[model samples]
Target: MTNSKDLAREIVEGTGTEVEKGRGPSQASQITALARERYELFMSEDGRPYGVKVDGANIALPLRGKAGLRSQLARIYTDAHDGSVPAQSALTDAMVVLEGVAQAADPRQPHVRVARGDGVLVVDLGDADGQCIVIGPDGWRREQRSPVLFRRSGAMKPLPLPLRDGDGLAKLRALLNTDEDGFRLLVAWLVAAFIPDLPHPVLTFRGEQGTGKSYSAKMVIGLVDPSGAPKRTAPRDIKSWATQAFNSWALCLDNVSIIPDWLSDALCRAVTGDGIVDRALYTDDDVVVLEFRRVLAMTTIDAGALAGDLAERLLTIELHTIPDRARREEAELDAAYSDAHAGILASLFDLLADVLRVLPDVQLTERPRMADFARVLAAVDKVKGWDTLESYKATARDAVADVLDGEPFAQAVVALVDRAGPGGIVLTASELLERVPAPDRLPKKWPKDPTRAGGQLKRLAPALRTIGIDVDDSKRGPKPKKQRLYHLTASADRRCETASPASPYDPETDSDQQEEGGRYRGDASGPPATRGDAGNARGDAALFVASPQDTGPDQHGYSRGDAGDAGDAEMHPLSVPAPRTHRTPGQDAEDAPQDARPTTPCARCSRAQWNAEGSPLCLDCRTAA
Candidate 1:
């Protein structure tokens, strides 16, 4: 009577291989050896043992879990027996297989969510077959096995083969149920996710009940990474969160009402790539290290004033309640979406192709937090004539505005500046703290002292600047303590400005410095500014005099104020294309609108400046004073 193990060994090692009765390997040992021959073992980048096996297809599995070595052994036993094996023996066989492979494993590179191959991108489908979608510049194709090893989480669901048709993304849009702006932002998020190398923005769905926020978010998750359970509850700990992230490529947290500070922070880290280590279940020095980045989306009723850091990384799309008449059954809606998903996926990949093609040419004047995302999306928008990036920026600006209105410190700063008037006020941290006491929302959250108050103001400055209240705490006052100086300035019209203020020093008053239209040329009193030289031999300052063709500079929309922050600064249109026809220096003055003459003092030297260069200052003003 052949026992299950003996039969399993025969089936795996091949039926009827003769061996000396006394010298033949035992059944379990023989099965383990045969299993080792059938599967490949390798170490993870972090030094954990993993196995890859082929049973008509290749798949990578973890060595530590039942899903890996243990599962494989069970399958082999079942194949040989043509029926179930005793549970105890099956478990023992799995342990033996694990020991066999783990000892001889070799090291290899590992990928989390996605991988880049030669001129191609391999996106994990998270399907049971361990298949991946391989995309190239020409188009995309599905593959049974990946060119690179991917550590897949069992929770990841499979994505359908993308369809190619004339329909475009029509089906997808109907299901999303958002306005044009929301749709564009959503598309941007989708496009950003496929490119794993860049940091992805967090996508959030917001609305009251019956709005179908969860359904919409679920559809997105389905397209990117389909899962049996599309949404998950908030993880209890960092390790738990990592586990959730590792198991799924697209993380959807449903019904999130509030994001605590720690979770908010963790989300930020996860989107940009985060790593963790936990002590192994029973070992002292052994630890499990997981490093991952995920495409994170969530559905919420009201997340409530997001943390500033978190808000910066969010693409918050507000959804509207579905009218009772317009609302469809979840089953019906999901069915339609599932049917159209393939086509929608194809459309997104098409957009991604265009993005990658035009990425090298994307020349953004400024970069935000996820700049790579911004650049590629901007490239696609420019090429496809889509306003996605613009819509995103507009949404960001609105969020910033809301943040300013919501935060007491931010509101106080605006009030303080409004009281100071257009002339603005210069105050120390202690003085500023005295002027704006902490608001009542969170007493502990408010800055404790002048130093903390100063830091808080700095943090809120970027948001405040959007409302034309610029905060400059970079410069500090002299001395025993070197207390920081808070430079609060505002536009009388409550409009933000990016151009540096023109100098207050009047070159017109000095005959040697003044040229036509009072524009400064090289100092006539000093030796001629050596060709490119700015100032005299002593390095006093370079003052340029216009060549007196006598006309005002072009009317450039000018706002002369502090634009020290990167994103708040406005770029002038007249500065580009180098003026179609070259003009005599003073012809600029002739073309200028009389009102376009700049009145603000140069941020550096306080000298009144010409706006020809858009900001103030005739030249670099580091030494102009």
Candidate 2:
């Protein structure tokens, strides 16, 4: 008689088919039964096979193909049977075949882990009971686990909670300041954090030292992670951003002096939920993971020149030092903070529920930055009977207005529009140059030459579009050259009609009629060429004898005297282009010497140097030198 162990050995050795002297046909049946009993294929509930494993510990290792399966089984054979080398080899091959047959018979076993991201709301409801709660823009419910990847990883320590009350609300309101637009923006940002996959705007806090930028950041961080601490240093670069994006739930860089270009690009990607591929730590293959679209905020004394696209994606919250500001530092506030946070959390849940309940019926005429958030606020109005949505819009509008006001070209546009008055005015390129005040007349950096001003106007079209201003080319009313018309309409109106090319700017026509006067002007010559370009010709023929101030680029990527941060290098339209090198009588194209260093004149002294070190200033002219 062939016992079960003997039959199993025979089957593993591939000798089950060969009948022994004492074994009958029944022994083959035993071998088949034992093979079926020894291995089973485990699968996930979602239908992913966890792969084949032995019956004992049932470990799922990455064993696929004949070579891999044989290798895996040879180890198992040695462990199970204490077999000799040749016997182990035969058993590995035999078990590989047997496991294949068994897997073919019954291929699936079940295992499951639940994870999901709602476009505007994500809550990690882990596989455990009584741990998390689920809320949405439409409704709310409590669950055992949280869906937030940052929260799930235990990166944050949530504060202990007590029953809610209205007492803490008043104090909290005073602390955050309900009247300030910055406070309102913070609330909107908090609401956005609960939203799942949408690109959330980066919240940048710019203020002088001791103005509570870091404190404000701590409050925001507490809302997201409850008891989390903000990382008080800037990330080194994009690679660091990539690594940190995966680790931190919400990144809050404090006192950032200069935002590197690469970090800005990475932040854009992180906001958009784009994936970044990096080489795995130990593996040769590249690991492509979803770029964590984590909530981002930063505190800076002076935010460096942000790329234009990045600027569009940022919500700047300017903090100021007040003489008699309310007293309560983070440490002093921590005593009441935990209970206050608990109340806020409870209120927040209630707010989310109300928003979701009325969301479908709420109507919004305009979508602004954080538009979806506005809709949520609209829902809050419908259900909570609060004027939250109106406040939200007002806050966002003012923030944008402030950004535009900071920009030199944008300010020039505003000045022109203000001059146009209630009915609006259309000015010809030449007329516009005559009417729009020069930098000396109004603010700074206004193009003095008509053609240079026209070029500035063209570059500023996108900025104008942001503020609901319209611009178009027209060849209206007996004009040989096309006139670029500025259509400044009531900001409440989003769309603007194109100006009539046939209707030229008439100091006589009503501003309302200007739109109807212009016929479509297609493919006409742009503003006439002027000496130098918009950059150098900014002082073409100064309207006044204004002395130019020499202020170097400060930490904010602007001259020290500027009201705010300068536009990014890529977005800075007025930066002078490199001077053209014209051949002299004795000069040839080949005569130009090639050198590793820049041939342009030094920024400081404006003198050309043959051996200038890589600095923007010549060696002697450099500040450090």
Q: In candidate 2, how many clashes are counted?
A: 25
TM-score per candidate, chains pooled: 0.72, 0.51
lDDT per residue for candidate 2 within 498-542, as digits (tens), equals: 322222223233221222112111101112232123112223323
- Candidate of highest TM-score: 1
C-alpha lDDT (0 to 100) for residue 114 of candidate 1: 72
Lowest summed lDDT window (length 10), candidate 1: 571-580
lDDT of 1 by residue, 55-112 (tens): 5334567767667666766677667767655364545664545655566666776675
- Poorest stretch of ten by lDDT in candidate 2: 516-525
Choose the strongest candidate by lDDT: 1
- Superposed on all Cα atoms, the candidates' RMSDs to the truth, in angstroms, are 14.0, 18.8
In model 1, what is the error at residue 24, expressed in angstroms? 4.8
How far residue 274's Cα lies from its native spot in candidate 1, in Å, is: 0.3
For model 2, what is the alpha-carbon lDDT of residue 88?
A: 45
lDDT of 1 at 609: 42
